[model samples]
Target: MDDLFARQDVIKRLLNESRRWAFVGLGDNPEREVHTQARLLQRRGKTIVPVHPSAATVLGEKGYAALADVPGQIDVVGVYRRAEHAGAVVDEAIAAGAGAVWLPLDVIDEAAARRAQEAGLDVVMNRCPAVEWALRR
Candidate 1:
């Protein structure tokens, strides 16, 4: 737990340097955190790719059903699913050749985070990219 939080620099780099971000579980619902964060990332100059089972367009951007379905390189996979479901997303992120995996607040899975880190991905768990960006500002 301590080690994950201690890697704040990694998280910052992931959020700052990564160009394309695939947001799993993101949908058209503006009320959801995914939608909010996606907009925030876009505002910060990060390309946001919305990934949802429904394949619904969000925030004027086309959506994909899964990570592998995304056409281009995904530098970061922002996971918004439940804690238990995060492992599968992390695995998919690795398979998709993402540079990092970000599990937002309340999506805690130590094993999944470790797996992502072991796979050479910068992992950020239980943190909000938008909040981090604000703090860095």
Candidate 2:
């Protein structure tokens, strides 16, 4: 596995610089981690684009059925799906020309992370953006 995940500089940069975060698998359920994290990002002034099959509007932002459906640049692609499904989302994020791919918390897919990195996108896996932000304080 690549050492990219261990790089604090990269994590800090992604968390600090990236503005628009497209959260794949984000649903309308407020109890879900995706919803909470997306809200946190929004509270921090980052634009959150929810991407799900239903394309339900989440956190007051219009949702898209897929990453491709999201118009304009995506600064970060946050994968809230299971590890097995993450690669496909990462691929879509790459296709959408995102600046980075973030696999939250327990979600881990080394191959997908590698693929995103190979595609010139920053990758952060097995991490929570909210926690990362808290740690910076």
Candidate 3:
């Protein structure tokens, strides 16, 4: 990934100003990191759109099976799946024309990140939005 890809300012903007965050792999289990992170983002006033095949509502928000299924524009796509699965989600985010792609802690894919950057989408890898919010807020 290029410097612009993981730039702190760009990531911060996504973490701060992005209103609609589609969280891929976010399910109903409160024990999952995605679940808690989604809640934290919601607490900070970001609209969290859950994207899971389960199609379960979470944190009072309805769920969609995929990013393309979401009706409106998505500012950021927060990927919560395994490292192997994150690339596909990143590609989907790019295809969906999202402003940025956020790969949470432990979910890293350099090629996917490069793809996202090449697509003109800001990329944040191996970082947690909730932690970033804590530091920035």
What is the Å distance of residue 127 in model 2 from its true position? 0.7
lDDT of 1 by residue, 46-125 (tens): 88899999999988889999998999789889999999999999999999999888889889989988888898988888
lDDT (CA) for every model shown? 0.88, 0.91, 0.88
Residues forming the 10-long window of minimal summed lDDT in candidate 3:
1-10
Model 1 poorest 10 in a row by lDDT: 1-10
Give candidate 1 misplaced runs (Cα > 4 Å): none
* Candidate maximizing lDDT: 2
Tens-digit per-residue lDDT, 1-137, candidate 3: 44545578977788768899999988999998999989988998999999999988999999999999988899999999999998899999998999889988888899999899899988888887767777886
What lDDT score is found at residue 20 in candidate 3?
A: 91
Clashing pairs in 2: none
| Candidate topping TM-score | 2
Q: Residues 9-120, candidate 2, lDDT per residue (tens digit)? A: 9889988888999999898999998999999999999999999999999999999999999999999999999988988989999999999999988788998888998999
RMSD of 1: 1.1
Model 3 stretches with alpha carbons more than 4 Å out: 1-5
Candidate 1: residue 58 lDDT (0-100): 89
